[model samples]
Target: MRSVNYARPTPALAIHDLRKSYGDLHALKGVTFGLNRGERLAFLGPNGAGKTTLIRCLAGLTSADHGEIFLAGQPFKSSEARQQIGFVPQEIALYADLTTRQNLEAFGRFHGLRRRVLRDRLAWALRWTGLEDRADDLVGAFSGGMQRRVNLACGVMHEPRILLLDEPTVGVDPQSRQRIFMMLDELSATGTSILLTTHHLDEAEERSDRIVILDQGMVVADGSLDELVEQSVGTQRLVRLRIDRPLSAPIRAGVAEHAASFGATGEEEISTRIDDVSDHLPGLIDLVRRRGYGIADVQVEAPSLHHVFLHLTGYELRD
Candidate 1:
């Protein structure tokens, strides 16, 4: 096998103005992104939104009609580039007849590892994936989560600097999903740059350092979670209040002037959107007290990633 070097000091991955088309359908419309060493990015989009296509391009499994892809500051089509990157597909690709350890050994050898290196990788991978006890068992006998773990181990056994994962946690139980996230965190700590694509928005929100939201083969939003939420969703913050008595017309008009929109005297509570909740909340409470209304409760709602996606695309993230 080729000598795998984990100590290289290069930009983990880079893509410049990538474009791909299949007849009338444009799979990728000038998509571009770059990742530094040890960075973790989440590629998010709905079905047919070019997430898979972009992954395929990065993996060198699909050729781009236009644009350039680089790995470790070198052309991605080079053999060295292919050897320096690890790809874990959405589908579990493994030999059912082979034991988990055997599968890792086979892939390690395919990557040009010597017998001794392959043995060491096998042990490390099993331990890393929490499958050391199940090493000798055939992959066909393992549960879905166990098999998924093995699938991940296979990709990382060679210790590629850049790891590309396509929906790696799909169809797994909550426990397994959490385990996968933990393993990813470990990998990142060790300086492995990861580019993962998934529809699991909440998990992405928690784990990703940067979120890239794609729509119809275009990048609609890209930034930190808070940045995306603030940019896509309106700046106005929502505040809900429950008063002891109904409000009068003048007070309602005052609120309307200060707020973008408001509804009062509801069956449960009064909700309004204000530019600055911190400053306006006090005035609102004081007005209610002056009107002889008792304050029951108040709740403030800030913009979330879900709300950001909805506002930018006019559809839910899952849709």
Candidate 2:
């Protein structure tokens, strides 16, 4: 029989059975996940969730005691891995005295690019950051948004296959934040896998291709927002109403099972779970009229990551 070769594409990055600790405290516990080529993953966790520990391990800044990290399907080696990973820490990392071009050149050389190649990368970085006009100016003189661009541009001068970002838009204005994501979108077009950690729930929900939540050194949830919502909290939304005055006992008694719960509660505002807004909202409004209860206000809270995070991780404040 003729042999047919069927080769599988390697993932951009993978962590398997990862474990790390600090004395009696466990920093990571059997953590496992994968980043497909060109995928954008939002890594989320509350304070002290060991997010920093994992990022350090992957960036070669610190070693993991037990887990194996794979880059392009091969075991990680410091020298080889350096070229495959790019890290942009949350804090700005740049020399205040150095010009934008100078900083780019220095960072590019650090990653082993030299001579003509380094010059070409510098040109690319300038364009990528939209700081071409300010290339000759010291980075310290630039505004927060401009410096943030340089911070981001420095990390990608070598164009690694994987990027790790910690709050990539932390200090920039809204316009700059939008521009930053635009730059990220361009990088994504080139097949770079990104893993970012941020407390901005809205950004994670909208921008990330997938979400991985960590709590107490373990993976609590991993999936799209809808998928995680369905798994952890179900799809029901809460519909709340504040009545101008309480419903009389006779009116309360007349409420059917559907609207009865709305009146049974002793509070001025009552809420109910709804599966569909279009089908359920009209009836609820009608019930308010039939009972002669004036609705002062109404609110609907959808099932989202905010709910999911609190659901799986609990409401207790994390120090």
Candidate 3:
């Protein structure tokens, strides 16, 4: 097995001015981004937003009409650069009739892994994907989640330095999703750069090192969650608190002083939009407590990637 150096500082992937089109219809328009070694970059975009085309271009499945790509500082179009990348598409690519072990073996062989290296990779892939117990079982007999894991395992059998995943956890249970993230985390720890395209906003916010959003075949937004929030919604945070009962005149006045606007109202619930909840919530809670009112619940709403997406792109459905 080849050793991976986690301390390398070079970027694992880079693309500049990538453009693709199908005659009159353009798929990607001047998209540019880079993935640092061992980092997890989440790619997000609306339907028909050039995400699939970009992924296909990076994986060499479809050549970009115009662009420059580099893998580990080498020309991405070269065969040597291709060896450093792995792709796990949204669909399951393994043969259902093949046993789990057989499927992995086939992938390993396809990657040109042989002799002791192939055996070791086969063992490691099964164990890493938690399929050791089902190694002899046919893939057709496994659950959807299990099949997803096998699909992921096959993609990385060659131990590529960079992995690209598209909707890897779609339709899977929470447990399976957690396991897949954990495996990806381990891979990142071992210096594998990852570019993940997922619809799960929470996962992208929590798991990714950086996030990029594309719209209309162009790069609309790219940054961390905090940066994106600041760009989209400024320094605002929503605070929803439920008091024991309706707030009195004095309490309402106090809340009004801190709130820019009010939201949904209930008998005991108060929703206020504040500039920053982290700085004001403690004071508000304390004041409510001093007024003989017990707080039942509190929810802070921050600008999420989903919100930014909707704000940037209209809510109309796309084909």
Per TM-score, the best of the predicted structures is 2
User: Which candidate, 1 or 2, has the higher lDDT?
Assistant: 2
lDDT at residue 128 of model 1 (Cα atoms): 90
Ranking by TM-score: 2, 1, 3
Candidate 2 regions exceeding 4 Å error are 1-9, 249-260, 263-268
- All models: lDDT? 0.81, 0.86, 0.85
What residue pairs clash in candidate 1, if any at all? 1-112, 1-113, 2-112
Q: Which scores greater on TM-score, model 1 or model 3? A: 1
Evaluate candidate 1 by giving its C-alpha RMSD to the native, one decimal: 4.9
Worst 10 residues of 2 by lDDT: 1-10
Q: Residue-wise lDDT of candidate 3 within 1-319, one digit each (tens)?
A: 1223435665788899999999998989999988888888889988889999998888888888888998878778646655788899999999999999999999899888999999999999989999999999999999989999999999899999999999999999999999999999999998899999988988998889888998889988887777787888665777878888775544543345654433233357766677767688887777667767788999998777778777767788877
State, as a TM-score between 0 and 1, how close model 1 is to the true structure. Answer: 0.87
Q: Is candidate 2 or candidate 3 better by TM-score?
A: 2
Lowest lDDT block of 10, candidate 1: 1-10
lDDT of 2 by residue, 131-224 (tens): 9999999999999999999999889989999999988898789899889888987898788888989988887887788899999999999877
Model 1 clash count equals: 3
Please provide, for model 1 over 1-319, each residue's C-alpha lDDT reduced to its tens digit, 9 standing for 90 to 100. Answer: 1122335566678788888898999999988777777878888888888898988888878888899988768877757766778899999998989999899998888877877888888889999999989889999998889888999988888888889999999899999999998898899888888899987888778888878887778888877787787777777788888876665533453444554323444444677777898798998777666766678999999777678766766664534
Instruction: Report clash pairs, candidate 2.
Output: none
